[model samples]
Target: MDKKITNYIIYAVFIVLLFLSTLFKSFSTDVLWPKDQNAKGSFDGIIFSDPQDISGLNVTRTIFKENNKNLVKYDVSFLYEGDFGNLRILGNPVSQIFLPNKMNPVFSDVTLKGEYNKINNALFQENLKLKDLYKKVPDHEFSTTSKIRVPLDKEVPEVKFSMLYEPRQITHGLKGNIAQNAVFVTNARVESFRDTTKQEKGIKNESKNFQESGYYVNSIEVINEKQIKSISFESTLNSIVFIISLATAILLIWLDKNKSQVPLLISMMLSIMTVSRFLDKGATTFGILFIWTITGYLASLLSYAITSEENKIKTRDFKRSIAWTLIFLLVNIIVFIIPRTF
Candidate 1:
C-alpha cells in the first residue's frame, strides 16, 4: 500500500467521524436557554352570564410574600352598558375566592364600585338629574373598578384564573347520650327601604338592568431571572469545553500521522484526554474526550501498519485496529445512550 493513499484515508476517516460527532453534539441536552418566562395552565377569562355587553376588561396582578405567606393582589377595570346605580354585582362565595393552599378555609375579600357616564342623549338631558333617569330609558355607560386579594401558602410558578359557580349550604346540629342544657333562640325584624311620593314620581321610568358582561386577563407567569441566567452560563461553559476538545483532537491526529512521532504524540493525546475527563465529569465533555482517544489510538495503529517492513507486524497492527474500533463503538453506545435514556 502506498503511504500517500494511507495518509489520505486516515484524514478522510477522521474528518467524517468528527463531522458526525459534531452533528450529534448539536442536539445534546447540555445546551440551555430561558424556560421560565412563560406561563403554563388553562386560563379561561373571568365568567359572565352574558359575554357581549362588556366593551372591555383588564386585569393586572402583583404577587409577593407577606407575613410568611404568598399573596396576590388583583386590580380589575371594565366598561359596561346600562345605568351604574341599578347594577347589582354579586360574586360567588365559593369559586370567586381563591386559596393558595386548599387546607385553609379563609375566603379573600373583593370590593367593586362603578362610575356613571351619559351617552349620546346627554345634550337633551343636560338639565335632567341622574336620579330621575332610573325609570325613563337606559342611555348611559358605566366603568367598574374592583380589587381582590388572594392568599397562598407558597409561590406559584404560574397562575390560572377561571370562574366557577356551585350551590353551597351550611347546617348546625348536635347529638349526645348525656343530658344537655336547654338553649334559647331569638329573632329580630328589620325594615330597610322606604320611598316618598315626590321621589317616586320624579324618577324616570326605564329598565336599569345589565344586558351583558365579560372578563379578560386570564393567565400570567412568575419568572425567576436569576435561575435562567445560571442555566445559560453552565451551557456556555459546556459548549466551550466541547469546542476545545474537538480542535485538540484534530491537531493531535494530524501530528501523529508522521512515523517517527507516533509514540510521543499518542502518549500526549491519552494524557490530555485523561486529565480533561477528570476536570469536567459532564457527559458532553466525556463523550468528546472518549471520541478523541479512540481516534488517536487508531491513528497510531495505522502509522505502525504502513511503516513496518515485516508482514507479521503489519498484520498485528491491522488486527489491533479492528479490535479498537469495536471497543470504541461499544464505549460510545454506553456513553451516549445510557445517560439520556434514564
Candidate 2:
C-alpha cells in the first residue's frame, strides 16, 4: 500500500527484465544457425539446380559451376536439376558443397611457379581487409553468396554428380515414379580427341532445326584450397566486448543501488552494445545492424523510464522487490527455453 513499496516493486520488475534480456538474447543466435550439423561442410563447392530459367539455361549453369570450383572444390561433384518445361524461376539451388580454398596448407612448391607466393600474398592482404570489415560489421550483416570458377580439362577428367531421392509422398506428379531419380553431373568436359560436338550435331540432324545446347563455354578457374575457421572470439574481439559489458553491468548495479542514475544509464548502454556482438549470425541485410543497435538503445531507454517513474530502488526494499523481479525472470525463461522443449 505504501508508495515506496510500489516504486520498489516497479524498479525490481525492470531490473529483472534487463537480466532476462541478457540471458535469452543468445537464443536468437541458436535459431539462426542449426546445431544438428545438417549443413554439409565448412568449405565445399557450391552446386545448384533451378526449375526456372533465370541463369539462362547454359550461361547460368556454367557460372554456377565456375563459382563453385573457384571458391573451393568439393571432393564430391555438383549437379543442377533443370525443369525441362519452365524457364523463368531463378534462385540459388538446394545443396551446398564446402571444399577447401586454394591457399590452405600455407606452403608453395619450391620450384618456380611464376610468382605464386607474391600472388598469394596479395590475395592474403585483400582477405585480411575483408576479415577486418567482417568483424566491425554486426553478424547479421554478413553476405551468404559464394562466387567461384573452375577450369575443365584433361587432369580434371571425370565430372561427378550427386542426387537425392524425393519421396513420392511430397512430390507425386512432379518427380513421378521413384525409379527415376533427379540427375546432376559434375566435371563435364568436351573431349579434345573425339568429335566433342557430336551430340549437338546429332540433335540437329534429328530436328532439322537444332541449335547448340544454348549454353556457352566461359573461361574456367580452379580453387586448389580454402579455409573456414570456427566461430570464435578471436576474430570479433568478443572477449573485449564481454569484459566491457560485465564491468558495465556490475558498475551500474552498484551505482543504482547507491541512488545514482547517470552511471546506471551509461552502464545499461554499454551492456546493450556488448550484446550486439552476437547479432552477427542472423542479419540478412546491412540495415539489420542499424535495427539491432536501435533496439539496444531502446531497451536501455525503457529501463531508465521505468526506474525514473518508480522513485525507490529495488535493492533498498528487498522482499517485495525480489517477488516482482521473479515474475519477469520466470516469464522470459518460459518464453525462450520452454516452448522449444515441447
Candidate 3:
C-alpha cells in the first residue's frame, strides 16, 4: 500500500472516531437567549399579614413569570405591596419601589421538575429582594413570598396599589406547634389602571394569590441590558461558532484529500468544540460568567489556530502560541481576582 494512502486511511479513521466521541458527549443545559421553550412571565399578588402589626396583618405578593411565549412586558407602574411589616428593602427605597430596573435577564430554558429546591436557590441568588432575608418566618419560611419589582417595560408608567394590613408580631395567637414568629399575607388586589385626563383613580380588578394551585411565575426582567437584542446576540454567537468549526473540518478534508492528517484534525476540532460548547452552556446556566467568558475565548482562539489553512508548524510558533495562551489565561485570572480585591 502507498504510504500516502495509508496515512489518508488513518486520518479518516481518526476523524470518524472524533465525530463519534463528540456525538456521545452531553451538551450544555444553559439557555442561550431565545431558546427558552418554557419561558413564561406572571404578575403574582401575595397577600399576608404584616409580622409587626398587632391588628392581624394580611399580605399579598405578586410575581410574574416573564417567559418567551408571553409578549407582554412589565411596565414601570408595576408595584409590589409587601405584607405590612418592618422588612429591609435591599437596594431600592420603599418609596421608589421599582422592579430591579437594572437586573440581569435570565433565560427560561431550565426546568422546574424535581429541581424545585435548586431552582429556588438559583432564584434567591439572582434576586436582590430574596438576598435581604426579609424576616425569617420559622418552619414555613418558604410560604412567605418575597415581592420583587421586575422591569417589564421602559415606559415610566404609574400604577395604583392599596392594601389594608395590621402590623403585629404574628404567630403569637396561633396554636402550639405552628411556625414561630410568623408573618401572613392574604387578600391581595392588583389593578392596572390608566391615568385618565382628569387624574382620577380608576378601579382595575387584576388581583391574585401566590399559593393558588398552578400559580407561579417563571421569569422576570430585572435589567435594561437584557434587551431582546442582547438575547439574540447570545443565541446567534453560540450557533455561528459551532457551524464555523464544522465547516472548517469539512473544508480541511476537501483540500487535503490525500493527506490523512486532515480528517483527524477535523475530528479533533469537532470534539473540542463540542466539549467547549457544553462547558459554555453549563457556565451560562449556573451564572458563572468568569468561567464561561474565559473558556469561550480560549476555545475560539484554539479552534482557529488548530484548523487554520496556514500549515507552518515551526517549534517557535508553537511555543509562542502556548505562551500567548498562558498569558491570556493569566489575564482572565487577574480579572477574576479584581472584584474580590475591591
Q: In terms of lDDT, which candidate is strongest?
A: 1
Candidate 3, residues 115-150, lDDT tens digits: the string is: 234433444454323222222222212322234323
- Return model 1's CA RMSD, one decimal: 23.6
TM-score of each: 0.32, 0.28, 0.31
- What lDDT does model 1 reach? 0.33
lDDT of 2 at 106: 16
For model 3, where is the 10-residue window of minimal lDDT?
172-181
lDDT for model 3: 0.32
Better of 1 and 3 by TM-score: 1
- Per-residue CA lDDT of model 1 for 1-342, tens digit only, reads 754455446545644554444444422322211112111111111333233433344444343345653333433334434221112222332235443333133333333421122211231243212323111122222222222333222233122333232211111011001110100000111111111111122222111111111121121223223333443465466556545654554554454344543443344333323333233222343454465556556554644543443312365666776565565455555654464544
CA lDDT, every model vs. true structure: 0.33, 0.30, 0.32
* Candidate achieving higher lDDT, 2 or 3: 3
lDDT of 2: 0.30
Clashes of each: 6, 25, 46
Give per-residue lDDT, candidate 3, residue 215: 25
lDDT of 2 by residue, 190-294 (tens): 221111112221111110111123211121211111111223433256547646655665555434443444455444444444443444432222213333333
